[model samples]
Target chain A: MKIITVKKIENAVAQLAREANLFLRKDVLTALKKSYRLEKNKRSKLFLKAIIDNAVYARKEKLAICQDTGLPLVFIELGQDVRILGDFKQAVIKGIALGYRKGNFRESIVSDPLLRGKPVYQGAVIHMDIVKGSKIKITVMPKGFGCENKSQLKMFLPTVGIGEIKKFIIEAVKTAGPDACPPYVVGVGIGGTADYASLLAKKALLKRIKLQRGLSPACPPKQQWREGTVSGLERELLLQINKLNIGPMGLGGKTTALAVNIEAYPTHIAGLPVAVNISCHALRSATAVL
Target chain B: MPYAAQQQYCRDCPSDGKIMKILNAPIQEKYIRELKAGDEVTLSGTIYTVRDQAHKRLIQDIGRGKELPFDTKGAVIYYCGPAKAPKGRVIGSCGPTTSSRMDEFTPLLLKKELKAMIGKGRRSKEVIAAIKKYKAVYFLAPAGCGALISKYIKKAETVAYPDLGPEQILKLEVKGFPLIVGIDSQGGSIYDKD
Candidate 1:
């Protein structure tokens, strides 16, 4: 058995929050660079270039990538053999608040949803899972509302077809239009209960966008998947979304979406729940294992 | 200015061999009329920063006939909320927020002679109509490029509603701020013509 202190977890969360907000993930950055190189529209090209430059500037200057430093979401993979030394929940919430304060990130969480009270940073939405190894992995994703507000979910009949699902996903992006920044990383969650599916979709955004074909030299060769698998669906959906031509910032071009990531789980025979979560080009997340 | 000479005004763009115009803020109605949808331009001058909460307060104040913190006539409003400035910095990452959230209050502000708005996303049909009626313009800053955009903001100072936290209004002095004309005075928009 391995032991981990809550203080260590807290400190790790704090660091992860700052890093996630300040630095664009490597895979995301590479995708943006590739998009910039291939973008045909002059306006789209300029916007992509600005995005790339912004990431670089944010990293070098240690500044938040966007003012909407976002609501901090903590995802933890805890090994079953690892026993924590302190109150895990409090440690995470404290860590998030401390990190936001330390980084000067915006306090975006409103105390009350309907009455609309003061925005505070004392809480975080945390998801924890137990795995086999002794190591603990923590990932922080700063979900900006611009795209989060555009996320959609539909509980389809068990009899529905793949085309219907595809249509629903595309329509979600269409409705998002220029509102949520485009060149989006689309996350699709399939085959779970309604709430669980939404969570899965949100989690899918953390998947690194693997470049296909000649998009990026640094990206490893594309992984192979069976014709009926989730990976194959992801590739097909990506192609269809880019065809929307929403482009960078929705100015209209062939590079509407950078990547589409899907995560699926076995579900009851009664319903098929699919959720789509769109993230802007500033797909920010940081992960560390200890 | 001759078209050729106007094209020479800024060398940072026109990479596609297109003309990129430069506009100074507190922009005149006539100048706004000359801008067409999809025109790439660089903006310079003073603008006010506002977000959802600030807009709510502004509209409420207008309803109560209370004095506004800044002049609305010919003033430019950017839908943005900046991060707290780090040490030795003028301001932290500041970028345009989605404009549609403010669609409810936009027409009234347009009626108040607000000349332009800077934000990402499409405006409502009513807001677009108001733009035509008032001859105002809607510009889009590159979304999610906050760190790069902050470089153009030479100064930022909170002007009102300090208790609103990040959503407080700020007065910003900007130079060479990049923008694309999303909707022009004639009701034409980059999103669609019809």
Candidate 2:
């Protein structure tokens, strides 16, 4: 049995938060480069250039890539054989506060949602899972409010088919439009309960955009799942979404979405649930294994 | 120079039949008429920053016949909630927030003589109508371009609503803030026509 201390985990997370906010992932950068090569519209090209430049400026100065430093969504992949020595949640929160303070990032969270507003950006949302290995892997993805606001969830009858799902995804993208900061990466979660469906969609977003076409790394419970993996659905949705005129920043162009990722789980005989979680161009995340 | 002010300083800059102007806050009607969609401009002088919560409060004050915290006439209201300013910097990574979130509160603000808005994303139809009715303009800054946009702010001081944290109303001194005029007083919108 391997025992990991909480302090080591916190230190790693603090660094993760700083790094994620500082740099755009390599795969995402590649996707942006591809879009730049393919785009024909002058305005769209100009906007894409600015985005590319912004990434450079953010890294060189160690400044945040965007003002909305975003909420820290922590996903931990734990090994069943490993044991943590301290309070996992508290350690993560402490790491976030430390990282944000040192990183010169903004704290956007509020203590009260319906009442007074606070700019406290230090809080984090964490999701942990146990896997087969003994290694602890943590990924911190800072989710901006603009993209988070545009997520959609709808439940359909079991008779509903792929055509309907495709339609719903397109409509959601259109509805999200400029608000979600298009040139987006859409994560579609199908099956499972309403809540799990949404969670599954968000999980799909945590995967790198380049790896989405093949076997998704983070699959739901292997036992209860029966539906053929929807990598095909992912490709179909990607084709449809890019066809929409909502180009970079919804200003009209060919490169509206960077990728589409879908995750599915087995559900009740009478139910079919779907969720879409859209992520902005600055897909901020940093991972560390302990 | 504030990035916006640098753009504003190029008042006489014209290229390919496109006329560019450098404008200041508290803008006048004649200048508003001269401006058209797709024109490039740099805004300088004083601009107020307001997000959804502060906007709702302003609307409420108008209903109660209370004086606004800042004069609205000829003002440019920027919709943004900037990151916390690091030590020695005038402001942090301050970029425009989504303007549509403030749409319902906008017509009321526009009626009070707000000449222009600095934000990212498209405004609603009601907002476009009000921009035409009030002869105001809307500008777009590239979304996710926060670090670059921060260069436009020369200084920032919260004028009111300190309790709102990032949503606080800041009076910013900006110069040559680069922007493509997205909407004009005539109701022409860059997004709408395209």
Candidate 3:
């Protein structure tokens, strides 16, 4: 068994927390630039330009791309053979606290949802998965409220069918409009339980934009098949979404959505759960393997 | 079919167009009611900061008839909760948060003689009603352009609720702060018309 020191995890979390806020991932940037070229509306075109310029400025200044430098969402893949030397949770929290403080990232986590109280927690959200390997993989995603507030989750009957799913996705985007900070990425999860579906939708967002070895990293390899075939479904959904003409900032343009990713799992015969998680262009997340 | 005076004025005006001046500023809210949509104004003054949590607390205090920690009358309120600043900087990527979340508390604040609000997105009907009733206006600074906006804020100091951390209310002194009119006192909204 391999022992990973808690200190290493702490340091990695802190550094990654800061880096994710300051830099736009290469995949996100490339997608945005592509949208900029393809967008037909003049107003949305200008808005997209400003977004790209903001990305550049944020990088040059080493500052957050947006003020709402969201809560620290840590996704951990723990290898079964590995053992942590110390308290893993505390180490991760410490890293998030230190990173946020040093980087000047905002503390968006509030102690209470209602009654308006102080912030009790430093990090935003942490999701962990235990795997077969001894190495631990940490993924940090700083999700701002703009896109987060627009997220929607619903459980439908098995008979609802694809037309209903398409309608739901479009309506979700329409209701969100400019509020989610348009020119966004939409992640859809089909099947699974309601809660599991919501999670799968979020994880679908972490899939890199680039094609790796002629296969989309956003979807699992065919050999490791899940309950249903979501890869083809995802590609079709992405094309339909872009046709919405929501544009940048919902100004009525061709580049409303950059990509749509779908993840699925087997569900009970009675239920067909679907979830949609929207993310803005910033799409800030980091991955570290130990 | 123009009146004599109007005819002369129309003839003198250029048919192509007139350049609209775009005023930019560090994010801050201060006396925004005095401004109107399509009116260009360069801002330089003191503005306070707050967001959903801060607004909720402030409104709750008002409901209890308790004194607020700061004087809000005739003040501009910026809808923001910036990231922490790097070493030696006044603030970090200080940009606007969404405006709609604070829509519930705005009318109450307006009753206190608050003048202006700065943020992005559409306000609720209650907020629009308050703007029309109280003659207050809302402005939009480009969202996601935090780093660029931070360059204009000359100084920032925490005024209250420091324990709120980033959500802490701050009193910021700004110079040449830039913005575009979003909601006018006449009940006109850019989001509505555009």
Candidate 4:
């Protein structure tokens, strides 16, 4: 029975959009540093150094880390108990338009994909969900075009099995090579329909950059996993993916992928759908709770 | 057996100075399939800008044998879709969109004598083969280095496909634009060797 004003959402989105572009999240940065140390290829090591330097410069000058600035993808977790007081969509779009203008981020959205048309809107994509909660949560993930362009999804026969899934992921990464910008995060969505699986794959990427800083209450203690028993499937997948040696920027090194995240949903008996979404180290996303 | 020594042989290349001028204003066509592995050249001229959607349309147009909006001979095309310019600024944060997406269209363009390309990322085998056949070269500008690249562009004007917005075909005049050799006429790729 709580009324939330659209204006609050607008302001929150604007602030989040600007912040996400200018700053690299702490978890992503930490992971990058760790990868930098473990990288074996000299060229990749140098490349990682340059990436780190660019991040530092971007932060100091309050500029975007990459030119694409990405589309403003807004994930909304709306409380069923709350009603919006005004035009929520318009307010959010307005905020995004204004934020891009102020932040000096690029307007990469076009109105239509065919006939080479004009840009009717400023933001790229916005996703929303209403869930059972008393508080509203909004997350902004501004994904650059390089990694976004490399995302791939395909549905296989129900009997394709896990081995096929692994092959698909490896092929996708190999095809992506240095283009997706390496030292990247790979999110794999297994099960569900083709479209839903792809969406989940992208959603899994929105999980905050993994951290080594301290214990996460959301995750079981590390030793518990070491003892084996949890979803050992995901842990094993993580180990295999990191061993690919695609390395940073595909120059060949120790860490091609920073982490591999997987999410699953029950699917129809006819098919097994898989989608892989790659995210660079920038991992720029912010959430606001209302 | 040091890594530095291993890199030395890969980095050495012969530099040939053959300058090509892009004249007749916008939409110059240059064949890229004929260039070699280690040639150097000063590119003087006008180049058109397009990325993603434009490439898709170009492929479709070629498939349909429809007359494209511009000529393709001896042309140096730059892969970029710039932001809307503010007042008094020639262009906004203009940078190279990843070039791999354009791979499917590049060989088609090379057949028509499209000579040079400027972009980032590794080109596909089709593109490299076309470059070798047409004697064209691919140039790589630094990725994510838009702010620096914008300084080299002296003037910008929309030439064709105005409706494409940022992906519109625009004639740009650039000076001293820095780029590294990507694919040479000999079918050699710098991305793989480097």
Candidate lDDT (C-alpha), each: 0.87, 0.82, 0.75, 0.69
Query: Which 10-residue span in candidate 3 chain B carries the lowest summed lDDT?
Result: B7-16
Give the lowest summed-lDDT range of ten residues in model 2 chain A: A212-221
Residue-level lDDT tens digits of model 2 in A91-127:
9999988898887787688867777566675588889
Model 2 lDDT per residue over B1-194, tens place: 43233332342121212335677786777777877777777777999999988998999999999999999998889998887777777887887788899999999888988888988787889999999999989988668878777777899998999888888899999887777777899999877745
Q: After superposition, how far is residue A222 of candidate 4 from its true place, in Å?
A: 8.6
Worst 10 residues of 4 chain A by lDDT: A212-221
Best by DockQ, which number?
1
**What's the TM for model 2?**
0.91
- What lDDT tens digits, residue by residue, belong to model 4 across residues B1-194? 42112221111111112242212223222323333442332343577887877877877898999988778877788998775554566766566777888998898888977777888678888888888887777876545545445656789998777776677788888765645556777778755643
RMSD of each: 2.5, 4.9, 6.4, 6.8
- Residues A185-236 of candidate 4 have per-residue lDDT tens digits of 7777888998889888888877655544332111333554652232344455
Q: Order candidates by DockQ, high to low.
A: 1, 2, 3, 4
Compared with the true structure, what per-residue lDDT tens digits does model 3 show for residues A66-152?
877776689999999999999999999888888877777766777567744565336557788989988999988888878888889
Q: In DockQ, how does model 3 score against the reference complex?
A: 0.37
Two-way DockQ contest, 1 vs 2, winner: 1
Tell me, by TM-score, which candidate is best: 1
